[model samples]
Target: MGVFYRAPEPGAKPFVAEGDLITRGQQVAIIEAMKLMIPVEADASGRVLEILVADGTPVEHGQPLLTVATGDADRAGPGR
Candidate 1:
């Protein structure tokens, strides 16, 4: 429902880059609309395979921000 931003602000480092390992609920990007910064987080723990959105780009609701390669532990379920 807002614009997707890979970085917190222009010229700043992105929250996550390709090949980076991320855990569930980890902030990967932000969505800004009406001056509100909404954090976009990972749904599962995994290695980042790709970033589907560019920094400061506009995005729609349900749009993918990136692709992640889920780890075995993630696929096997929690507490593995």
Candidate 2:
């Protein structure tokens, strides 16, 4: 597990948010583990439906950090 950050640094824009369009390999969050900061990215392009983890919170392995609606449609359900 590691501390999660929406924005890696202070004063930086959030990586992702609700209703935001995201692309493949887009950095969505940051995980700080063992004093190292790692980025979490999206596997597919889609619109961000929801954020599952709060900023600065600890996240476990295989945790669902957020939900995305894939494809050109605006479907933000459980499909993704």
Candidate 3:
């Protein structure tokens, strides 16, 4: 949420794309609010499933930016 931006700037390549492997804390997108750019990072390491918003698109608070398919280790209990 908060005005999603897939790319750093106009005509620039996106930080990530569908099927791209992402790690936690890795910047996936940017959210601009009040002229400040806020990095949107991955909560968990995973493969990107989809990008829910376009570059420079305004987004709402709590709106999903993208879907990620985290590895089983993230979902399963330890010692399994």
Query: Which stretches of candidate 2 lie above 4 Å from their native place?
Result: 72-80
Taking all chains together, the TM-score of candidate 3 against the true structure is 0.86
Instruction: Give the alpha carbon lDDT tens digit for every residue of 43-62 in model 1.
Output: 88888888987777788888
Task: Give the C-alpha lDDT of model 3.
Answer: 0.77
RMSD of 3: 5.1
| Ten contiguous residues minimizing lDDT sum, candidate 3 | 71-80
Models 1 onward score TM values of 0.86, 0.84, 0.86
* Candidate 1 overall lDDT versus native: 0.80
Look at candidate 2 and tell me the lDDT of residue 21.
85
The TM-score of predicted model 1 comes to 0.86
Worst 10 residues of 2 by lDDT: 71-80
Q: How many clashes show up in model 3?
A: 0
Q: Which tens-of-lDDT digit does each residue in 15-79 have in candidate 2?
A: 77799988777888889999999888787778889898888999898788888888855333331
Candidate 2 overall lDDT versus native: 0.80
- RMSD in Å for all candidates: 4.2, 3.3, 5.1
